[model samples]
Target: MSETELPPEPALDAGELDADDRLKPEFVRSVLDAVEEGDTEAAKARVEPLHPADIADLIELTPADLRPALAAALSDRLDGDVLAEMNDWVREELLAALEPHQVADLAAELDTDDAVAIIETLEEEDQRAVLRALDPDDRAAIEEALSYPEESAGRLMQRELIAVPEHWTVGDVIDYLRSDEELSTDFWEIFVVDPAHRPVGTCHLSWLLRTPRVVQVTDVMRREQTLIPVDMDQEEVALRFQKYALISAAVIDAGGRLVGMITVDDVVHIISEEAGEDALLLSGAGDGDINEPVRDSYRSRVRWLVANLFTALVASFIIAQFGAAIEQMVALAVLMPIVASIGGNAGTQTMAIAVRALATNQLTQSNTLRTVRREIVVALLNGATIAVLLGIGAALVFANPQLGVVIAAAMVINVLVAGLAGVLVPVTLERLGQDPAVASSVFVTMVTDSMGFFAFLGLAVASGLVG
Candidate 1:
């Protein structure tokens, strides 16, 4: 930001962070230098001006060994907001370094959802310790959130929200809001509730400020609003927020009573996380966070690699069935790999698109066939282009017209099968209640590789090229 555009008293220095919001290297170096020099106050002064997110980033950027010293030097700045903004792995490590009471104090300062995130990952004993340290009200809220399944809307929503009865006028709301010292200050809207505390409407703060004091709360509130079930998946919650263009929505219990609220900021995090997760799952990299521990990264990736090995064996077994043809015609061995390679690439291209479409809810029951048909047409065009090029080149190099025609036919057949497998594998897995991104690559790769070799060799023999 330019000097003039900056706030009169900015918490964040405009020049300290790069375009990507990362702390500048020089700033990091200066802070670390002060910390190492035992000038704790200087280090704090340098970091104290940064935003909570930037403090989190600074801690993350610090070396593992030095993080303790840095955290100590700036312990006062490492508040709940900074912890909430930190990476999961990093925050877990930092929280581990603190006492249960200290962690409880930090958790108590946060909204119910963020507090739950920090506490839910603790060991059972540690969780109890933290819970015991928390105030009863805070403990109860966190305990209730913990009862929900991991990654459910209940775990994502915060208990802190603004809810006023519909019978109240704007004057009453203004008075109540002003009279109540403990109400959350972060709410964007005042949710209008029924006698039973179920959300009936939502009134943005702007509506309250603009309306006359005599206006009934129901008169200005928007009646149509999305209500999220507490048990809904976080991913589905994100989709709902996106579909409705919501800034915030009330989360309801099974009885349709208002329980908590999910804000757009929470959905943004879920969107980024799920998008990255789906991409990693497609590649079988499993929780592909660089901050992940080495053993965890190894364990997650190795299982998939093992599955891939078995899938490779299936393709190898297919290749063995055509050994006689390969022995008779050395040309078959020379060109078989090319066919498989092309088919595998083709399948991956379609699979990525299909998985993303499925994730974003763009590809649904109504459009499945249409999507398949479109991919088939694309596959045909792609296959024909590659086949013609390979065929012409093979005819010239091998000096065999029959061989070129055989491989060309095989190329077209394999690519077509590849496209079908790419879409069908994920879709079928989704239908069977499996994660398409998780298992689709293995099945799709196996289908493409096996079908490629089988088609090329089978077509060559059928064309009498081997004879």
Candidate 2:
């Protein structure tokens, strides 16, 4: 369907497209127009109707210098969610630009995870100031959450939860929930806990409402709860949520006391973060936030590019050794790249699979040898197919049977080596306490390139096909 024919965009207002609903392109044009006309009131009017998240996105989309002006235009509407949704580095700069009272006000409205996320973005002194400005209770809760290791479940979980002792009846649960002045604003399940406050079980809201009020909590609650430990990594939490098909899970502290809770909504964010983080890290790009400052982006990306250059020099050094060989036969120069390209592509395919398997803990020592063998087999079959096609092409192109056979043999050997290096290098790196994903790609590429050149050139030299 055409863009206009598509269902009305949600970002737009009901029955009409408002300035707040304008996406980046439209928003940018409108803001630029306002700036050109020196229309501050017009800009404010255009920005005022956006949701906090939308406003945050709009601010982020604005050029860096214009952020302060945008912030001024939006003023008090820049709430907690907007701050939370802002990229960390951008949030850091923006929080610095905001007053302490403004930062604290936004923090107070956010859930514990989002509040901590924004607070942690501040400079150390600013973090202290923002914390100090918060109410004592909010400050204490946020501080306690910050005490957990960063990116752990404790830090990510919400402090708010619905929990009751196992001895309580369904009626008691209903009454406590109804009468208690303090309860989480959002909860999908009620945790049944021990006297020690350790989660023993959980009951979905549906189960609680449908079961007779007279039923014991134990009778109604499901015993098989996936209680997440506070120290668990957020990625693991997401995995558990996915594996158990859970809507929410209770979180426990070091002593196994119920401390907080995590929901699918939080898990969704964690999953996205972890997945994107791995992708960026694999490319040696730090954070990869679009809103990241240009300098920060350059710093994060250049080191890897430099490292790649050094490695490319190493590959070039290898190629230089065959200068005489290439000079003797122009066909060798033409065909060498073919061999390297094929091997590099093959290695990358396997490296990606291995890295993903390692991340998921599916490629452990128990199955490593088996997986390696299977990959080698697959590589051999693939190599045979490609080599045959290339062999015929080489024979037709160069009109040399020996050259065709030589390239064909080199292709097969290099591809097999490529496949083995793909699995072995990554698995070994992971075992040696290195991140398999980040370093594996570079090493795999190096191996395939070097091996491809060496095998093809070495074979030709051995056969005395070139001198």
Q: What is the lDDT of residue 55 in candidate 1?
A: 90
Deviation of model 1 at 234, angstroms = 0.7
Q: Give a tens-digit lDDT track for model 1, residues 43-127.
A: 8887766889989989998877778889889999989999999999898888899999999999998999889988988889999
Off by over 4 Å in 1: 1-22
Task: Pick out the ten consecutive residues of candidate 1 with the lowest summed lDDT.
Answer: 2-11
Alpha-carbon local distance difference test for all models: 0.90, 0.84
Name the candidate that leads on lDDT. Answer: 1
Ten-residue region with minimum lDDT total, candidate 2: 3-12
The candidate that achieves the highest TM-score relative to the unseen native structure: 1
Q: Which runs in model 2 stand beyond 4 Å of their true positions?
A: 1-15, 18-21, 31-49
- Per-residue C-alpha lDDT of model 2 across residues 283-311, encoded as one tens digit per residue: 78888887777898999889888888887
